[model samples]
Target: MNAPRTVVTDLPTRIRRAEPSDVGALALTGAATFLESFAGILDGRDIVEHCRLQHAPSVYADWLADDAVAAWLAETVSPPAPVGYAVIAPPKLPLDDLSETDLELKRIYLLSRFHGGGVGRELMNHAIAESRARGARRLLLGVYSGNARALAFYARNGFVKVGERRFQVGGNIYDDDVLALDLRA
Candidate 1:
C-alpha cells in the first residue's frame, strides 16, 4: 500500500501511488502548479513565498513521514513525466471537532500546460476512488474563491460548496470556499 502502484498504464500519463521517494517531486509539482495557477488570483510576492515554503525539500519529506496521509502522482515518462499529483487525508482535523466521515483532498494539481487535457480530472478520479476504497463517506477540499477555473472544475466533478474559510498565505488573507462530494450518494 505504501509503494507506487499503477492504475492506468495504457495512457501515456500513468497514475500511481506516491511513495517516500517521490515526496520531493510531488511537493515541487504541487507548489509549481499552485504558483502558476494562482498567479493572477494571488499577490505575486505571496505566491512566490508560498511556493518556496511549501515546496521545500524538508517540508515534503516531513509530509511523507506523516502516517495519516497518502498521495498519488501522475507521470508520463515516455512523453515527459511530472504531469500531476493528489494528496489525501482522513479528516485531518481532530476527530472531536466534527462527526462526519470525511477524507480531505489536501491537494490535487496539474501543471498549467496540462490543464484541459484530462490530467486534472484523472488526478481527481484517483483521489476519489482511493477515498471511497478507504471507506470515506465524503470528500472535502478548499479552493481559493478567486480561482474560478478550479472552482468550476470541482463543480463539474460533483462537488458542491459546503463551507468557507480564510486562508493566510505569506502576509495576505484569501477567502477559500470549502467543497464536498458525498461518495455514498
Candidate 2:
C-alpha cells in the first residue's frame, strides 16, 4: 500500500487587544504600512513628516492610554511579527443627525504582505464586535478616496460611503470618503 500524504493548513494569525507596551512596535508597523500603502500618493517630504508626527511612539502611547480608545493588533506565528492593527474611537468628523451611540473606526492598516490573507477581515471583525459591545449603534471610517482597494474591502464588510472630507498631510490636502455601517441593522 502506498503511503498517504497528509494535508496541512496554515494556522490563523492571532489578533488581540493592544497594550501600552506594544506602542513601539505599533508605531513602527503603522509607519511602515502607511508608507507602503500611500507613499506613491504623497510627496516624500509629506510622507516623512506625516509618519513622524502621527506614527510616533509617543502618539501611540497616548492613544493606548486613553480609556475611550480601543486598539487591536494582529500577529503571525511563524516568525512572530506585527502584521496589522486597528483603532476605534468616538467620531471626530461631524455627521448630520448623528446618534449618541456612533463610534469611529479611526484606522485599520496591515502590512502589504498580509493582504488577502484574512488578517484584515479578522481585525475588522474584532473592531466591529468591540464597538457593538460598547453600545455603538454605528461605526464610521474615513478612507483616502484614491485607495480603491480599501474602499472595496470596507464596502464588502457593510460600509457605505456617506460623505467626503478633506484630510491634511503636511501641507497637502487630499479628499477622503467617509463610510459608515449601521451595527444595529
Candidate 3:
C-alpha cells in the first residue's frame, strides 16, 4: 500500500529544515538576497560589509548548531538551487520585556527573481508552523522602515506594528519597524 500524505501545501519551491550541511548554501542565499533587497536603499559599502560579516557560513553554522533555532531553506527542485530561507528562534526584538512564549522570525529572504511567486509565503508559513510547534504564543519580526514590499507581505499575513528599532547594518544605523503576530489567535 502507498503511504498517504498528511499535508496539501503546494509550495512553488521545495523547502526543508536547513541542516549543518546547508551552511554554504544558506550563507550565499542570505548574502545575495540581502544585497539585492538593499542595493539602492542602503549605502553600497555598508551593504557589502554587512553581507560579508552577517551572512558568513560560520554564522549560519552557529545557528544550525543551536538547539533552539530553526531554519528552513527553499530551493528549486530541478536545479536544486537555494532561492530563499527563513529562521525562527527565541525573541530578540526591541520589546523591553518579551515573554518566554515569544519567538522571532529572525530572517526571511528570497532572490529578487523569486518575488511574487508565492515562495515567500511558503517560507513564512513554514516559520509560522515551526513557531506554533515550538509552543510560541506570538511571532515577531523586524523589517526596514522603507521596505514597502516586506511590510505589505507581513501585513497581509496579519502582522501588526508593535515597536521600533534602530538596527545596525555594518557601520550604519537604520530604522526598523517591529511587527508581531498573535499565534494564539
| Candidate 3 positional error at 183, Å | 0.2
What is the per-residue lDDT of model 1 for residues 1-185, given as tens digits with 9 covering 90 to 100? 11222344355677788888887788778788877777666789998888788777777677678876778888886875777888888664323334356889988988766666677898898889988888888888888887777888999999998787788787899888888898998
Q: What RMSD does each model have against the real structure?
A: 6.9, 7.2, 7.9
Candidate 1 clash pair list = none
Q: How much lDDT does each candidate structure score? A: 0.78, 0.86, 0.89
Candidate 1 lands at a TM-score of: 0.85
Candidate 1 residues lying further than 4 Å off, grouped into runs, are 1-11, 92-97
The number of clashing residue pairs in model 1 is: 0
Clashing residue pairs, backbone N/CA/C < 3 A, model 2: none
Model 3 lDDT per residue over 7-75, tens place:
323434698999999999999999998987888779999999999999999999999999999999999
Q: Which predicted model would earn the best lDDT?
A: 3
Candidate 2 Cα outliers beyond 4 Å, as residue runs = 1-12
Score candidate 2 by TM-score against the native.
0.91
Q: What's the TM-score of each model vs. the native?
A: 0.85, 0.91, 0.92
